[model samples]
Target: MTTTRMPRSGSLPAVRRAALVLLAGAGVALSPLPAQAAAGGGGPSSAAVAAAPAAAAASSAAQTVVSTALAQKGKPYVWAGAGPNSYDCSGLTQRAFAAAGVKLPHSSRMQSKMGAPVSRNALRPGDLVFFYNPVSHVGIYIGNGQMVHAPRAGDVVKVSSFDRMPGFHSARRLA
Candidate 1:
């Protein structure tokens, strides 16, 4: 197995370098351990290297989903409204994921069951965070314990702290 070193810090912008490092970590995290044996050495196998691009793709998709949802910030939260204008909780998530080429149901309850269940400690940007016992509300997590959500009627889409929201039922990762 061969390894490549990252470019010197001076060669890349801080943000770009950080992203590369994070994506590389993501690749390792996503790679199946069983495939590491194919290399016959200590380094990542070809299978792990191949999985890197997939991790990058998923990262990009998650960014898109988060950005698309954030772009709607301040839009009125109309019940069941999905769109270029207003949005409901699920509508916002559905449209946001749709922008990333992933289809999600318009109901929070149904959408909650569509992705891999994620633990609170594992929450990442683009993970769906649900609230209430029966999961009546949903939000797109944006990391740092913050989430973007469309609160009920008379409210607008906004970034909110998890501490402000009650009844945290569960979370899921779709991207």
Candidate 2:
């Protein structure tokens, strides 16, 4: 019986591929991709199929983080607010990650220290971007160089270009 072959690893979506890599790095078992099969023996092994769910879950979590944050756009920016209506910089990020089952501190500086540091160029949707010297402000990256954030006391939650934000302290990947 001929089994259907799976796509090459390189062809997987960026998020899924990244998840697979992370799961592998975390010591999750994974079988070789169909492309790695020798000769005509090319199909997804049971282990390869088994690893797909975890990768998909990771991708889903990232999307949830992004969607949750984006939903708060236009909400008022209130100091120390972290809820269904208004939010502060770190509050918005904290709430977003929480929707995806990831816990993040309520302070931008503390959140900055939670996940793996990501270079500006490596940012993807759902990454947490920070600003200022001591990382006093935070935002959720939503791709295409745009991030959702609570700018200040008078500003509402909105999408802004990370490149234009003054400090550009750093970015971190939590999902």
Candidate 3:
């Protein structure tokens, strides 16, 4: 005796239908791709992958620099020393950068010698900006025209408006 199977109503061939469903699901899952990745049609686009780490690193660095600076707020101003007790303008920047694994010189004048000079308009969080006619003071630019610095001998480290500060010079990026 011979036996044969009958096709079910509205049902597709088992193997082909399963494969189609899987493909459709996959297509749906990957639909509406992110703008950075959409150029490649599917899968992770080069731009998206590349930008993610760069953005993350930049954010991490910014956070590290800001937090490091803020943490030292209220520390007395000690000349030429980057430490728990005190810091000068450049010294605070140096220690903050050091906390983020970037090394910098102890003096503002010396620190000014390193890194490309960035204009005030281009300043970003973590960029070091100098002040005073002789570049005697330095501060970490915290964006929005503000900087964290050891302002004076009596005053502790604090954030202040860069506009109000004197002798605005250039900025240095340690990262």
> TM-scores for all candidates?
0.67, 0.68, 0.64
Tell me each candidate's RMSD, in Å, in order: 16.6, 16.2, 22.7
- Compare candidates 1 and 3 on lDDT and give the better one: 1
Q: CA shift at 26, candidate 3, in angstroms?
A: 45
The residue ranges of model 3 lying beyond 4 angstroms of the native Cα positions read 1-57
For model 3, residues 80-175, the per-residue Cα lDDT tens digits are: 657767777877877666554345667899788665567777777777788766778888877655677888877777777678887886777654
User: Which residue pairs clash within candidate 2?
Assistant: none
Tens-digit per-residue lDDT, 31-130, candidate 2: 3232110112112223532332211122665777777776676788899998767789999887777665455678999888766889999888888898
Q: What's the C-alpha lDDT at position 28 in model 2?
A: 33
| Cand. 2 TM to true fold | 0.68
Q: In model 3, where is the ten-residue run with the lowest total lDDT? A: 32-41
lDDT, model 2, position 29: 33
What lDDT would each prediction earn against the true structure?
A: 0.69, 0.69, 0.60
Task: Estimate candidate 1's alpha-carbon lDDT, on a 0 to 1 scale.
Answer: 0.69
Q: Give the TM-score of candidate 3.
A: 0.64
